[model samples]
Every structure is written in C-alpha cells, then in structure tokens.
Target: MHLRRERSRKLIETFKASLTSFACEACGVDMEAIYGPLGAGYIEAHHRIPVAQLEPGQTTRLADLAAVCANCHRILHRNGLMSVEDLAAHLRARRGWPLAAEPRPEDWQGPDKG
Candidate 1:
C-alpha cells in the first residue's frame, strides 16, 4: 500500500510539473493572468476519470487529468463528475458560443483499460 501511495503521489507531481500554464481547461481561466504573481501556478488538477471509478490495478496517465480553476473544479464534481469537455460545452452554450466539435466516445477513455 505504501508503494501504491508513493506511486500516486509521484504521478500527480509529474502531472503538475508537465503543465506549461495553469489555465483552467474547462473555463480557460489562467490563474496567473488573473492574480499575477500570486497565482502563477495555482490551477487545480482534476481527474478526468474520477479516482473512485478506477478499477483495482488500473493505472492513470497524465492525459487523464485536467487543469481547472476552483470554481470549475467544484462545479465539475457538483455535477456528478461531468467530463471537462461537457462542462466547457455547457458553459459555451449558456453564453451562446458555438459549440466545439464533439469528441468521439473513444476520446473519453483513458489509457490502461483492462
């Protein structure tokens, strides 16, 4: 169990380090752009595949994560783990913006499917 925890921690660290910018993927809110130095690297990491949904022995990859702001993160969970793309579309629809092309179902599946 310790090894599992260590691996999870390292994976999350690597995922965060891989981010070039801390912009919310769903809302496009760049923390640094809004709060300047204070928010330079302040975006939250959200699991595209909720951690609880992972089957035993399933592994997560960087692509399974999404960079999001506090508001969008909360909203995502509040709406029952809605996909990042779905939330973005919902927001765009509310603003009457043209919806982005839908992703294929396969696009939603993360790697390491068992």
Candidate 2:
C-alpha cells in the first residue's frame, strides 16, 4: 500500500513537471535565473490538494499540482494550510510587486564586471 502510494506520487510529480514551466508558477523564479546553471532543473513540485485530503485510489489531476521554487513552496506550507494562490497574493501585496513581474537584466547582475 505504501509503495503504491509512493509510486503514484512520483508519477504525478513527473506529469506536472512535463506540463508546467520550469519557473516557479507562483513567483516565476527559475533556478537558473537566480542561481545560474547550477540551479537549473531544480524545483519543487507541490500537490494542490493536500495529501491529507486525498483518499486512497483517488485520481490526481495535473491541474491539481504546481511547480514552485523552494522558497515559495516553503511559504505555501508555512501555516500548514495555505493555498498557492493565497501565498502568491500575500507575497505580492506585501512586496508591492506585480503578480507576474518579469526579471529585469539589471536585477540579476553577477559580481561587478569590472
């Protein structure tokens, strides 16, 4: 039973990764964009439906999942019951940022190119 659940989880994660953008869905933070090549392909997959609410043998839909960076994912789970959208909204409001702010080149400068 446990093995089956684990395998199903993996399958869902794989499917989400294939369909979703490599950037964090909530903040659009791509690993490579921030951490450079070493961070490429590094992201966390979040299940939209809390695992506790899922019943055995229930079907997990791709839409019910999200790809997020570590920081955003952590914030999503901080209160133990925060939705992705809620977290995103809270962050945006607090930071006074646009919902889908694009990263500016000047925003990600490497060490002084002097």
Candidate 3:
C-alpha cells in the first residue's frame, strides 16, 4: 500500500476556507483551518474505504472523500479501524449540525448537508 499522503491543493485550500467560514458541525463554534505536518491548512481527505481495500482499477472520486479534521481522521484510521462515515456521523451528532436530511447525501456541497 502506498503510504504517501498527498492532498489536492485546490481542494485543501477550499476545505480550509470552508471550515473557517463555516461553523463546526459538532460544536457550532467557528473552527480554523488546521494544517497537516506539511504545513498547509488541511488534514487529509479520506475515503471511507481505503484505496487498498477497493477492487482493482477503482479510483477515488472527489465526492468519495471527506474533509475530516485531524482528531476525526485519527479516530477513523486508528486501530486498523472505523469507517470515515462513522466518524463523520459522530462528529455531526456531537455538534448537532445537519449532516443528513434536507440536503441529499450526494448533493452535499459543504456544511449545508446538516
């Protein structure tokens, strides 16, 4: 499995700006963009299913990834672990932000999904 963790540049910036401008889905508090070890205001866009776990020839889609914060990301991948969706739902429920309903799951263009 490739361990290289790379992020889409434009997507990273957009996510940071979105998080900053938007309130936290879990706390309703404004959150600032957190940088990865690389120093960019981004964590990592994670797929609920790892690429290594997918069928051959499968590639990641833009909508397939979630812009999770560091703690959520850690909880996701820790212990060989849980699905990103589970973490997302936990975060959503924790903050009581709209993550499902009203906005279609596929139509989620950002935090409005709550």
Candidate 4:
C-alpha cells in the first residue's frame, strides 16, 4: 500500500511536470493567467479512468491523466466522473458555442499564444 501511494504520487508529479501550460484541459482555465505568479504551474490532475475503477495490477500512465481546475474537477466528480471531452462539450453548449474540433495537446499553444 505504501509503495502504491508513493508510485501514484510520483506519477502525478511527473505528469504535471510534463505540461508546458497548466491550463485546465476541459475548460482552458489558466490559473497563472487568472491569479498571476501565485498560480503559476498550478493544476489538479484527474484520472481519465477513475482510480476506483482500476482493475487490480492495472497501471496508470501520464496520458491517462487530465489537468483540470478546482471547479471543473469538482464538477467531474459530482457528475460521476464525466469525461473531459464531455465536460468541455457541456461548457461549450452552455455558452452557445459551436462544438469545434479540439486541438491535440501538442498543437495547443495555450490561450495567450493563440
């Protein structure tokens, strides 16, 4: 159990460190842009596959994680682990925006760059 916790922690840290921008994957909320220096590189990781649902001996990779803001994270959990794509769609629909194709992470240059 201890080893599992340590591995999980390291994986999350590595995943966060891999990001070039800490913007929320679902809503594009850039914490640094919104809160300045204090929020630089700030983001919470969400499991694409809920941890509770993982099969025994299953492993998680960085690609299995999504960076999300606090509100979006809460909404995801509250809504039964709704997918990141689904949440983004819901937000777009709520704002009366068209559902355009989402850019891949590597192609996304963050809000300021675009």
Name the candidate that leads on TM-score: 4
The TM-score obtained by model 2 is 0.76
CA deviation > 4 Å runs, candidate 4: 96-114
The RMSD of every model to the true structure, in order and in angstroms, is: 11.5, 2.8, 9.5, 5.6
Residues 36-111 of candidate 4: C-alpha lDDT, one tens digit per residue: 7898888999999987678999988899999998989999999878999999888767654443233333333456
- The digit string of per-residue lDDT tens for model 2 on 12-37 reads 66775585357777666677766777
TM-scores for every predicted model: 0.76, 0.76, 0.47, 0.81
lDDT of 2 at 35: 70
Question: Candidate 3's error at 36, in angstroms?
Answer: 15
Q: Which stretches of candidate 1 lie above 4 Å from their native place? A: 96-114
Off by over 4 Å in 3: 1-41, 91-114
The whole-model lDDT of each prediction reads 0.75, 0.71, 0.48, 0.79
> Best lDDT goes to which candidate?
4
Worst lDDT run of 10 residues, candidate 2, spans: 100-109
Which candidate, 3 or 4, would have the higher TM-score against the true structure?
4
Q: After superposing candidate 2, which stretches have Cα over 4 Å from the reference? A: 101-114
Q: Candidate 1 residues 23-112, lDDT tens each?
A: 677766666555668989997878898776789999878899888889999999998889999988887676544433322223333464
Q: 3-114, model 3: which lDDT tens digit per residue?
A: 2235344544555555432322222222232222343443455565676676766655556566555555676678476766565576567656575222223332355432
Q: Which 10 successive residues of model 3 have the least lDDT summed?
A: 26-35
Residue range with the least summed lDDT across 10 consecutive positions in model 4:
99-108
